[model samples]
Target: MAGTSQARDGRMALSFILEKNGAPLTGTSGSLAIGEMGFIISKASSTSAFGDIPVGCFFIASASTTLKDGDSIQKVKPYFLGFATSKSLSQSKNVVDVTMDYDAATNNVSDGVVSSSGSISGSAITETLNMESGINILQSRFTSIISIDGSTIEYKEAQTTEKDILMLGWNFRDCKVGEFLDIDIVPALFSNLSKDASYGSSQTFNVDYTGNFSDENNFVGGHYIVKNVEGLLPSIARPQAAS
Candidate 1:
């Protein structure tokens, strides 16, 4: 793995991939439209015909094509989150002080401390959007939907059901023409949404989301660098318009 010498910008493209019962969708092949978000089902082995191409990862289709099993493309439509004005991810762990009575007497010795391993605390991803797309995103997680007439929709105060979603992000500065890096947050839960508006400023919504480890998936989610040989990832162009 190589490192970039230049400082990268914070610009990123964000989207969501749906999951059922805490697992990725079954892989399939078809005419994947350009800029479609999808993931790899299986890697193209050396004995296969498309051995040079990479698989077993997520990608954004660069062009429309209808191919056989050799062409690794599993069309999994993602819920594209509108352009984000600002975004941030945070994670922390619980720490305990291990200092004892004997250690207090020693002036040269530093305080002992230990952190709980294999777990993360306060893990969250906060994003600010200036569009109304956040309303649909938040409503998808709600279990109870009370619709009044044809235009009004109300959600109950107590939401006992949880909808697990997968978040995918792509950084423009970190990706190349034939390769790109992905930031994934699997088994994520929507926390809250707050609207901010003023007399002269545009209205924006602050979306708070959290992710945790899933015993079934065995991992929370992290950054991944993938090879996009068949133009399976987007670079400069924006994703398809949100429906």
Candidate 2:
């Protein structure tokens, strides 16, 4: 077993697709601009009570167009995240132990052993990437910012708001094609930024961001290890009109 075991590469590639409202943004692969706001689509079975059902192929909105609810697009590709310097995933469990008084001498027990109950309480993924360009810095401030058009960007400085929700995809360098990790952040936010510009040094911007998962509509956003079917695109189900 040990000789046959395979090791995975440490290097990973990060990518994401923007979703407007409830639909995904479609565009050429690896062409997403900074400050683009979008949502990740999460679907569950009508019969299942909880959790998201992973789909082989997901949709995206066109970079040249904005999408509204119930809108559909023909293109399907995800944008690559900037060069990542470091990345980590963190998860926590909320546990409670049930205890009761018990006879120590009769039971020969010095500690009470009853039962424990717990559930996933918190999860987050943090990553630091080297910004590819100056404009990429806008990603750090995109939580409350909106792009009215491809050329115009706005900051919601006057309103109380939350960060933009997005989906994160991580592909291992040595993994088989179409096998990767998928995570949906209720909102992905930039935590901090740093830049160094000095003689004989190329300007590199440190873009540190975090993606958080939370329970919403009986669906607790979490990570999914996706293994897409080889040589085939996911089938899309179209809504049928009344007969």
Which candidate number maximizes lDDT? 1
Per-residue accuracy of model 1 over 114-189 as CA lDDT, tens digit each: 2211111121233323223333545445533344545644443434346444555645333565655556555555
Report backbone clashes per prediction. Answer: 1, 9
TM-score of 1: 0.52
lDDT of 2 by residue, 1-243 (tens): 111134434343333323233334332222223222233333233321112333222332212233333332323233333334444444444444444476333333334332211111111222323322212333435433343545555444322223323344434333343443344333344555455567775555454445444222222244445443332211111112100
Per TM-score, the best of the predicted structures is 1
lDDT of 1: 0.46
**C-alpha lDDT of residue 165 in model 1:** 45
TM-scores of the models, in the order given: 0.52, 0.42
Model 1 pairs whose backbones collide: 60-232
